[model samples]
Target: MTKNFDRLLEQSLDELSVQYKTLYHDSDIEGMKPLAHVDCTVLKIHGDYRDTRFRNITDELSSYPESVNELLNRVFDEYGLIVSVWSANGIPLYAM
Candidate 1:
C-alpha cells in the first residue's frame, strides 16, 4: 500500500514546480550535497517505503540510522528553514 503511495507521491512531486530529491538511503545522502538553493529535497525521516530498513516501530524512530542521523544534522544545521506535510494516514515521525 505504501509502495503505491510512494509512486503517487512521486507523481505529485513531478508535477510540482520545483525539483526534489528523496533522501532515504546512503546514495541519497551522498547525492544531496550538490543541491543548490533552488532544489527541493524530501527527507523521508521515517524511512523509505520500499526498504525493509524503513522505520515504523517505536524503537526505530527513537534512534535514526547513522546516515539518516548525519543527513538530519546536516539538514538542521545547514538549512535555515524547513517545511513538512503529510495527509490522510500520515502520522508524524517526531511524535513517536
Candidate 2:
C-alpha cells in the first residue's frame, strides 16, 4: 500500500524531530522535512555550528553510519521511503 505525502511527512517529522533536536543541540532543530515533491524529503539541520554540532557529523557521506539506513528503512518501510539527507547549501549527503 502506498502512503500519501501528508501521512508520510507527519510520521517522519514527528519521529525524527526529537532525535535531531538532541543531536544538533538546538531545541528548535528538526531533521527531515518534506520537500516540494510528492515523495521527497530532506534533512533540515542548519550549517551553523553555534546552533548545532551536526556539521562535522553530517559533512561527509560516510558520516551517516550504516545503522541509519538500516533503521530508517526498517522504520519507514511501510511508506517505501528512502532517506536522502542534504546539506544546507544543497549538497547531498547520504541516501539509503
Candidate 3:
C-alpha cells in the first residue's frame, strides 16, 4: 500500500480500537483479535463475533463530519480491503 493508504488504515484502526475498547470493556483476546482485521476503508467487519460481522459501512461514515468522510473515503476507495471486522459478539456484520 502507499504511504497515504497506510496512514489512513492506521488512523481507522486506531479509531476502531478505541471504540471497541470502550464498547466492550470485558472483551477477551478472541473479541479483540477481529479488531486487528477490520478494513477501515471499506468498513468491512470480519471475525467470529456472534453479534458482529462485516457490516456495510459505506453509509456509516456519513455519521462523521465531511472532512473525516473525505479522508476515509479517499483511502477506502483507493485501498480498502474486503475483510472481517472484530466484534465482541460472534456474528460479523456485512456490507449492505
Task: Give the runs in model 2 whose Cα sits over 4 Å from its true position.
Answer: 1-51, 56-59, 82-96
TM-score of each model, paired residue for residue: 0.59, 0.25, 0.25
Each model's lDDT: 0.59, 0.39, 0.37
Q: Which pairs clash in the backbone of model 2? A: none
Best by lDDT: 1
Q: Candidate 3, residue 18: CA error in Å? A: 19
User: What stretches of model 3 exceed 4 Å from their correct place?
Assistant: 1-62, 86-96
lDDT of 3 at 33: 37
Q: Quick one: best TM-score, which candidate?
A: 1
lDDT of 2 by residue, 40-96 (tens): 333322323334334343344344445444434544664555666667797999977
Cα lDDT of model 3 overall?
0.37
Tens-digit per-residue lDDT, 4-75, candidate 3: 112344466576674322121112223433434543222322212233431225663235445434544655
Worst 10 residues of 1 by lDDT: 1-10
Model 2 residue 92 distance off true place after TM-score fit, in angstroms: 18
Clashes of 3: 25
The digit string of per-residue lDDT tens for model 1 on 1-66 reads 121215455567688755766666555666455546546676666657676657676886687668
